[model samples]
Target: MLDQSLLSQSRAGLSEIEAEYIASSLLRVCPPVSPQHTNLEVTKLLNEHPELISIAVVEDNKPMGLITRNVFMEGMAKPYHHDLFDRKSCIAFMDKEPLVVDQNMSIQTLSFKVLGSGRKTLNDGFIITDENGDYLGLGNGEDLVRVVSFLQAEKNRLVTESINYASVIQKSFLRSSRESMAAVLQDYFMHWEPRDKVGGDYYFCKKFDDGFFLALIDCTGHGVPGAFMTLIMASFLDHILLEDNRHDPAGALAIMNKKVKTALGQINDSAAEGFDADRFSTKQNGQSDDGMDTAFCWVNTQNSTLTYAGAKTALFYIGDASSDVQLLDPDRKGVGYVDTPMDYQWTNQQLALSKGMCIYLTTDGLIDQIGGLKKIAFGKKRFSGLLQEHYLKPMPEQESIIMQTYYDYQGKQKRRDDVCLMGFRF
Candidate 1:
């Protein structure tokens, strides 16, 4: 009897049988092609191979570039787009280094390639290639998602075997506030992210005995390290509330400003020379890069008072009427970028937040998300309009409205930067 046990492989206790099935089914064969074909011919080929995506633009049997469906469509729609019908070759509109994969390349490598091409349209897809630059049919985006989904199975096997335990490692770094005083928070929800896993944007909600604190912090960069800094800052905020006692919102921010500048070590000496780059590693290694921007606030909901202190973070508040939406602008200097730290003057704004009023905090992400292939952003003005339109909806439906509007604006393009949106209803 053929050994049935040989057919199964375990990862984190989940079986690879599903993964193997997917890998095999996805690698299913189809009619493949080469480049150097004309646009007219390629369009015809797409009709036949309707599943086709990228095609290498080969000249003299050597791959010159890639012609993706988007590039072709974009070119065809251009105001100068007239020669497409009688085009000599697809090379004219092809992407020189369009994201590609080699046949022998590991599946991990392939998975990363698809992810790096940024996000794609529902029907939009990617192409596979051989070492010799020959086309190997199309690869569906859903297929890559399936591979990651199955990796969880393999990861589980490792966990069960005690070889490795990585479950929740992806989310392990996210933490909650420690000090619980008289924190009174009625309700709140938010999504803070960069265009990537690591976001330079952050969110914090600390509940006090009588009031609560919140912030929408945007750091220096756009992705990767920027996101890492957000995590570090989040941890820093947690520690500040637990240890340091900065009771008022402005006081807390002033303390935070001093701590941040000390931590980032962006200060100068008597000679006007900055701190040694090498010695700055004591607190922050500066190895992965250091420094960030910020905005801090403390709202005494019980007392109906809002205290604001900003460093490069724009604030928006929407009340029952359109007139209630307000923007709290920051000074020219960000937290780490300034020479002399300014004294924190608490600007207390009195407001009577009725049941229908809302306060929104966001980084540039929400408004800056790519609107279309033409490259428009969702934008501040329109985003405010969206808030007004959804203000009438129940809190439960409001989240859906915001997300739907984001996707509708972003469509299928890759997110250019992190998107942060926090809305609080009274």
Candidate 2:
């Protein structure tokens, strides 16, 4: 048996690419030497094919071990080695502990196993087997490297194309014009940042005769799936608003919740509450656990009032120079929970506005970001302090300060989720 100590060391800290299967490079193998094959018979077979570096020793279709050309030649070169051993079975010198890999094993993983083996290199080659442990073929370290490199390049290209397309689609949803938003709330800023090229977070702004509708929403997941949900949400919200000309924040939310449930076929899913429909039925069953947490606000400068409603989202408010920052909490439930009552209600909270007062609406992404020395959440307390400290600045300046502060706090940490923040002053 070969010392496999090097293989054990190489297995540590292997990268993700090593997790891929070896099916692409699988080679056909045949004419394995039996354990009973005499060394003279094996030598003659090897000599006939000088190019064959190794041969498998198998019994009943199961691989027993491997024999390399170098070992055979070295043994034969020994004084009287062939005459003394040629008639003996080749199994006496076969590598019983040779590197063996399942056909489905990833090439990276196989490399780790081979390199970690106490051998200086995998020059002896290795054996591949089917799931049932039937001998498949012999593979070289060099060939494995070539195939894996090609596969990884192909995988990277496909992913890049998909992400670029998704980025385009996500940008299209941010269609609200600055003029339209300014017509409703004279001074406001909306910041939308996705954790990836595309994200699960989005902001919506629309103006009607009574006032303007503004919202920040965080969907269930991030990346492509989350981006898809954001598209669905934007479409549905627009359709709901136009259907009955509903402008009230709470009523709009109720419509959105019902529509999301119906779209996902979760209207009848009380028994499997919260079950992810997408996991079970990707084609037509729609999404389960696919809902948004949102903060919706209506501002009417005519009456100097702000009305807001939320589904698992909140609002931060600071009125005038002397008023303390305030948090307007949302209901505990988000939109589209499977068990949510069709008749469920949302609360519409109203507040009187003073000159130079600021209102903030955000998805949980901001407060939930992981960072700090302890790697804890940024939290609502710190968020509130940020707003309170900078609310006095112009809306545009405030946006810059907030973003810079958030990035400072985040430091080198990976972004945790999509973030959306909207601020306005009356």
Candidate 3:
């Protein structure tokens, strides 16, 4: 959180301006004045210190006054630099008092003051000296302005960095899909085109001695909060599969539904309006934690058996020999809409497995994309057709065809929502 915008990208951590500020660059108290020299000699002195910042006059270790070249020339009787130099000694031209400055004074207060005050005593700066008052340094107005700007910019950068670190932690806390998978058919891929990078779309897998568990879920919102729901679902599903070895898909859903209702406080009448809360207050008003709409199935490849359960989603199966498929429509009762008629029962469907049948699941994003095939979505009709058209291709090629079709259809239309599709073939 420390401000570090002033951090030098170069090897030189200190800048020339900063160094000058540190040097207390100014004429004061006992500035190296030229009262001891004549005006002619002043020219030589100027030539010697061509890089001179300011000139002054000193007497007995104290500042008498100061005069710059401009003032000296304006008061000169002759036009030539040498004439003015020869006409008077530096002491004869000492400007006046209040020309000196102290080291501790801010450079910010000095430079603009000088410019605006036209070299008057009221605008004069303080002289800075060492502990011994030995004329240690001088201050300037411009440097302070620059330093303040640098500090402000540095502060902003630090704030941004702090926010980024916090975001990384929050995102990390939201779980991602498990990649270490085993058993059954490993021929699955994700075509996850999220409306945002982290969206409500989710999929998970679990392997059991008798069958393999698979699911596709989509939450309510997109981005960070959707990802949070995804994480919650992942944790719960993992707990059910690994810890309890609960192979019944409907049983898992019933338990998960209850848990989510409790977690979101949706069981009470007061929280019934949680789903319709304003955008900003959704998190506070207990927005739908039932973000996941899932189609789950446990496959017993050895026994050629399948048990599937779904909620407010759809799944399809394509016969292996050709392009014929079955679409499994969910029981319209979503994960969370209302606990009203709390007796709503979730059903699990059983199917006999065939060697050539391919399994497919998708969120509405794909079918509902709204712009494909002449500005029209490849809706249910076309989706089923694609199954009939590409059913013979390997799962990977089949996926590519869908992507190709998406691009071909979405040439100019804006993408509407998150799209996800998964396929498994026996």
Q: Which candidate is the best by lDDT?
A: 2
lDDT of 3 by residue, 179-240 (tens): 42334576655676667655667777665676678788887665545544564565556545
Worst 10 residues of 1 by lDDT: 162-171
lDDT for position 51 in model 2: 59
Q: Which candidate number has the best TM-score?
A: 2
Q: Estimate each model's TM-score.
A: 0.52, 0.58, 0.55
lDDT for model 1: 0.54
Instruction: Rank candidates by TM-score, best first.
Output: 2, 3, 1
lDDT of 2 by residue, 340-388 (tens): 6667889999988888888888777788888878888889998888888
Q: Which stretches of candidate 2 lie over 4 Å from their true place?
A: 1-160, 177-179, 243-245, 269-287, 321-323
Local distance difference test values of all predictions, in order: 0.54, 0.71, 0.57
**Model 2 Cα displacement at 172 (Å)?**
2.1
What is the RMSD of candidate 2?
Answer: 23.8
Better-scoring candidate (TM-score), 2 or 3: 2
> Mind giving the per-residue lDDT tens digits that candidate 1 earns over 144-242?
433433343334333233212111211333334312211344454566555654556766667766567777777767544454355446545654665
